[model samples]
Target: MLLAIDLQSETPIYTQISEAVIEGIAKGQLQKGEALPSVRTLAVDLGVNLHTVNKAYQLLKQGGYVQINRKQGVIIEPNAFPIADEAFKQRLWDRLKPAVAEGVCRGVKREEMMILLDEIYRDLNKM
Candidate 1:
């Protein structure tokens, strides 16, 4: 997968790496069971430290997006969609609350927000 990073961004490099992987999956650039590059190789390619790549991989694994195998390296996980468990819902709410609040504060209409969400879903589904 092709991953890019913005060194000047406030977000951490590892977070950016993990988000790129997630976007790849959403865009169908990555498929289930697809093998990812070794952490060291990815770090070298991205001109970052090994630990940064490793941390990104670990986050992906924790989020159920990838799996790490001692002999096989890393691969995308099957059925990696987010579950609707309470914990997942809570976390989703926690993450969205700020953005939604900001939208409200900006006087964004419900229809506009819904349209934006639909556009994003359509974009992802186009993969």
Candidate 2:
């Protein structure tokens, strides 16, 4: 899995990790049944605490992205895809709300926001 971590980003590390894994799946870069790096390995590689990686992995497991086993390690679900959860929804909203508000503060009209949103949505759908 390829991830770009920004410690200074407004988003937290765990959230960024979870979102990156999910988006990798969405972008067809991460396939179902693929094995993920061990938490310890990833922590060492990323120079982060083991607990951070564990927390991220736990979030992925809770979202049904991957399954963990004592001996088998972590395996991406056979059909890891869309996950609908209130927490995920709220996280998305919290991230977007700030950007949207910034645009609004800059005098972006509602109709313009709708247009921009549609264009962005279409661009993402193309992926």
Enumerate clash totals for all models, in the order shown.
0, 0
Per-residue CA lDDT of model 1 for 30-91, tens digit only, reads: 99999999999999899999999999999999999998999989999965566779998899
lDDT: worst 10-residue window of model 1: 75-84
TM-score of model 1 relative to the true fold? 0.89
Q: How much lDDT does each candidate structure score? A: 0.91, 0.83
Question: TM-score: which candidate is best?
Answer: 1
lDDT of 2 at 86: 89
C-alpha lDDT (0 to 100) for residue 11 of candidate 1: 92
Q: Give TM-scores for every candidate, taking all chains together and pairing residue i with residue i.
A: 0.89, 0.75
Provide the lowest-lDDT 10-residue window in model 2. 118-127
